[model samples]
Target: MGARLLFVAALTLGVSGLAAAGAAATGAERCAVDDLERRVCLEAPARRLVALSPGATELAFAAGAGERVVAVVAHSDYPARARKLPSVGDYNRIDLEALVGLRPDLVIGWVTGNPEEQLETLESLGTQVFYIEPRTVEGVAGTLKRIGRLAGSEATAEQEAEAFLDGMEKLEARYAERDPVRTFYQVWDAPLMTLNGEHLIGRAIEACGGANVFGDQPRLVPRLDDEAVLEANPEVIITGSDEESMDNDWLGHWRQYPNMAAVAEDNLYTVPADPLVRPTPRFLQGAQSLCERIDQARPGSGAE
Candidate 1:
């Protein structure tokens, strides 16, 4: 009797220890992470998720956790798969009741990138809201790894990281020493909204072997006057989607500028804001497409 009791007690202790270890691992990595941004990413694994940021949505799908996602924010149309997901809200807005109805285990959003009011409503429901603050391509690797760990797929995440690094290496070699194209990226037309170097979209311009004409501007969105654009004199003008929320009609407006060098040479390009704007693994895919496009435009540049 004594021997049997001892064996049972030992087994119980072992089970308890294993359970504790699991609990420790499942606890979001944020509270423990020193960096605020990395910490937020650590809080994923997010079954029944509501993705508020386009980047986070891309990351979730890339991590192979798409089945766990319940809904995605508007305009997450990349991967062709994202479009099939249900809607939670737009980038800066949310339908709080709809999000609550989903009973999401996690809600991923952008820190300071989203409007405060929308964030608060989600938080009030006791849902874990993860904020990602990826600023560069390098930063994206960290986000991918952390998200993978949270989702219990570290191996997949590492593979993605390796693949991205390899692709970028080839891109760099292909464009190394080639003449840098001065490019103008227009986000909007009425105000002539353009991107600054600080944002991921602008950095993507550099990634594609081009220099942002507004590289010096600090704000993500800078309103440039017509004279400023003329002064910038971009060799290639890359505009995407429609400014008026209409199907990409840049071609219509672009035709009016027959005198512009980009128009004359047919350098006007349109990239969808959905996948192109998001900062996930697919983002590299989009940037790679951009590089291919730029290489095609320049012609003598080596194509990887």
Candidate 2:
């Protein structure tokens, strides 16, 4: 009887030791509010992470968690190292089993691009999910800081966030009050889509002393017919292309409409698609390029 009692006591001690070890491993609690307005908390810095979107992968790297990332989705090629990581799937479709197999401690998801069901599944499986969606320049900066806090990379994240804010401030000071050039920013070629003022790109245009012709459109991104383009008669037209060196075919198509002000002035321009389209720190690169293009389109700035 005494031997059995001693065995039970040893078993109890073992369980207590395990509990203590778990508590020690958890460290301190950290929390961040995501774009979904949900508060996500972690007992310790994420040791293994998975990013669900290309943009989120870049943001996680910026947060100094790049080394901690164990999985990513397609097109997350930024920072060079991210490309070497395993891919669970793309933004639209996720491979649930593959992602779960990675045993990620945290998952970063895009509010707009990622499927809600997949995110829900991840959460249901006891994985922490943080949704990020930055719609404005300021929002992007804030996201970096928040992500950094969650990942325990606060110092690096803060420095990057400050640099981004400073860069944006300089751009705003340089171009905010310049002559307003009537501009049309084409987002897609096949259907001819443009962003309204509510969109970040539209705000970028405004900051560069250019007016988006479709700024008043209700839709964030609206499809416009050629007739609308002819009617607006924008002073300059800008579009993002996949290749930095290649001019988009849409620009050539506009050349046929010689009467169009942008066509007549030779103001159709193509900027690098990566920085301009993605809501990452590289947006400043695209913003600078855009400002230069708009300045070139100005009267006497030089045409063709």
Candidate 3:
């Protein structure tokens, strides 16, 4: 922690650095930035905004800056008010012309996940973007603090971050007593893809006292087959529905796998599918929900 503070201190040597860098998430933040950081940096108390991910949208709402968002990605359905905001289309296939029409002061999205080509185009068009993806649960707090400062809602951000931190500590304590469960989390079954460990979701599973069946695999999302899954023989299976909604075909396909532990136990579930899909504040809710399902899959594994 001391080392981190020193790093931030050097990064924020002057007003110019403050403008260019996302400020340290501790105290009163100066949203001011240098001209270069001004072009790329985002200081909050942001009036006009666009959020291109469900997590980013919710983080804004959680930080009490929901009123500032003027545009959102098409799939960002949360807090009801987010739905009312103009849609800038999907993240991968963003409609640049439509986004520009909204005339937002700041645009928020994931730094790594979104298309760099599109982001480059947005930058070329003079749209300053903040790309943040929280890895651990604390990362969510750090992100909230950063967004809060950029949006000029330090008090709200701190409060929201504190509440999340407390919830996470409780979760950590709950799992401290037990050995980790061998669990398989299936994001998709067609190609048999699961999250890579570097991802926030996989880390969430590790923190929940359950081991990712594919923890050794090293991609953000790796594809596998029934043979690979069978090799793991996970004690529990945590899953969410597919892109086809809960339609008959999807359910029927899943039904064929009933012999599997997750299927045999009926451990499949329906999460928000929006915010839960992303790495944001709701990820705790997602992890908690997944934990609940896994506990059901194996009796006496977790809280009722």
Candidate 4:
């Protein structure tokens, strides 16, 4: 806890200092570097913005650019207001005519989620696209700042980013040094999928002082069979439910394997899928819940 506190303190101070310096240097035009390392510059704050992915929509709103978002893709349903926005299409397919009709001054996109050809077309049509892909916990915070910079909402964005960092620090302080437990996080059950170390959920497992049994898998999301899971025999098994109201049937399926360590100990758990899966501010809430669950499964925690 002490070491993590020190690290978080250093990180928060460094980011806050840099953000202030960067804000002071801004001129008439606002510019932000995207995930691709491409600089996107706007002559003024964008009044009409289109978000092509759900996560991007959430991020734009988090940056206090909600009113500026004129359109969003399907499933960009967060902040309650996003669902009411005009939809050009889903992440896979976009209606070019509808998108153009909206006269969006800026388009927020996902580097890996959105279709590449469509994004290129939008850029070719003179639309400014800011691509975001947050691969790490800190990267998520940085994305808010960049999004705010592009939208001319730096002040609000800075506050949200700092809040997220502080929440993460609290979770880290509470769980980072706890006794390590072997964990298996199931992403899906049809073919039995799990995340690799590079994925956010895998990092969440590590953050809670739990080791992802399949963290070394080469693929970001790997498919496995029951036999493979039995071999790994993780001490804890966790999965996410699509909504808070839904039951986690996937976790219950493993009960058939009575000899499996997690099944034997009944350490299976579920978290809200959207918060945990989405790389947005709500992720902090999800991570905290996960850490508490893992702590309860620890040797001296008095679990069944």
Candidate 5:
């Protein structure tokens, strides 16, 4: 089955499993698999936590452990309360002393974003670290439940996860049968980057019934020149911006190529950067917006 269908199938099975496991599970032991496929276990539910990335922080909060978080890395803003917490440093350069001083029983690390040496040092200091990198929408839900398990907030986490999965299922059902629209998603302006099918954003594009022009690329995020994008000539070109209004002119750069299908059909669009980029429950909202935009680009949907 496709990854999207697999997600729905897994969710149906996982919910029942979670309930049965929760009934049988003991408070003395907590275990979950990290993105690295490593089994991380805690003797007891964590009482104090530290998040190493903005996305990790959001997941922790979504798991109903916001009050347990002792520290967070930079840009951990969201849920309003996270901004008030102490900062250990940014994800790339962590301040070991500050983090250790917080006495966090659990440290949430970013698999690809965090510094490996720093994480090792934390482990050497006897701190339990859980690394996460959710590449698919289902991965995000799994991470949420795992964090909830570790934080002793399984009920809340499971509810939020179920809600997210349900929303995604609805989106898939709504768009899955629609005619596909060729798409190219711009990740960054400088160096010009796009995500491949393995990336979460690319997967979201597929869920919205849109085909990523660079989906077959080897790299998760590939850098290319303007000529390559011009050559792809996608039907719908999309980008994200930090600005809430998404008023930036990043997509305007495509205007020079009037012959491009996306430009010719005026199918260039932008969505909020945080919801789409972050691996959190808020991604559901982002996906909804994405599906709507792609629907507009469909030939019979009236954009033509």
Candidate 6:
């Protein structure tokens, strides 16, 4: 009787294990909508992936899919490990042959940064592509969650997204009622470019209680002359730099116009380009630095 009871217990455990294995084999499919409103579905969590832009690469790693990235475009240097991955080419132009050879399960594309024809061609080749372009702060968090969902790392992605939103909320709460500072953020020097309120950077300025001088421009990134900047006479001028020290002299040209409020008040500043320019979770660090600079420029803030 004792031997018979032990046999029955072992058989029951084996049957339970088989049932669990069967359930695992039929797990639910993963799907998410891209920024362009196109739904991408995967039969299984992407085991091999290719990121077409530096920002996309960063987003993938942030979604906890870093190890699954088989290939990335140029300048996907964040997370340190990404730099060691294979490159298919730059964001604008892809090495089709190389990319196709990798046999990635999913390809992460950039909406504006990638060529439309190339992406279509990639799709025609039976490759699944998901495009992303986050225009707002909330959009950034949403993209993180979506990417995480498709990558089978939803928990990590959700945590990162929540943390980013929390940081932004804290910033808004801290500076929402502060005195507004007129600001002009220079995107480029030659053919002088500035972002309108619709751009993510412009939104960051608004969050810091800084009024964007070019926020009313019709174009997202509008070109203007030095005369327009002089006319605005912003209180602070900020730009981004790729260097670690943020010591670029892009704002030096404005110094010659001492009559300009930003020049006169010496409120010109620079933030790290990667964090500020890229729509990623790390943007919180850039936003914090920007808010601090804007705060220092406020009256009675005691800046030398």
lDDT of 4 by residue, 54-89 (tens): 999999999999989999999988989999998999
Q: TM-scores for all candidates?
A: 0.77, 0.90, 0.78, 0.88, 0.89, 0.90
lDDT of 2: 0.85
User: 1 or 2: which has the higher TM-score?
Assistant: 2
In model 4, the worst 10-residue window by lDDT is 1-10
Task: Please identify model 3 stretches exceeding 4 Å from their true place.
Answer: 1-44, 242-272, 299-303
Which pairs clash in model 6? none
Over 4 Å off, model 4: 1-27, 302-304
Q: Which ten residues in a row have the lowest lDDT in candidate 2?
A: 1-10
Which scores greater on TM-score, model 2 or model 4?
2
Cα lDDT listed for each candidate = 0.69, 0.85, 0.69, 0.84, 0.87, 0.87
lDDT of 1 by residue, 1-304 (tens): 2454345434544553454456667774433131253344333344567788777788877766677788888877655788998897787877666666666656777776678776765555455576777778777876777666666667888888778767766766767666788788778888678889998878787877788899889787999887787677667777666424736665457667677766777776766554456677666666766676566567465445
**Sorted on lDDT, highest at the top, how do the candidates line up?**
6, 5, 2, 4, 1, 3
Q: Enumerate clash totals for all models, in the order shown.
A: 0, 0, 9, 0, 0, 0
| Tens digits of per-residue lDDT for model 6, 58-177 | 999999999999999999999899999999999999987777667676899999999999889777656789999998989999999999999999999999999999999999899999
Model 5 / residue 57 / CA error / Å: 0.7
Local error of candidate 5 at residue 271 (angstroms):
0.2
Q: Can you tell me which runs of candidate 1 are displaced by over 4 Å?
A: 1-45, 78-81, 242-248, 251-260, 299-304
Candidate 5 ranges with C-alpha deviation above 4 Å: 1-27
- lDDT per residue (tens digit) for residues 212-298 in model 2: 999999999999999999999999999998754756788888998999999998899998988888888988988988888998898
Candidate 5, lDDT over the whole model: 0.87
Off by over 4 Å in 6: 1-27
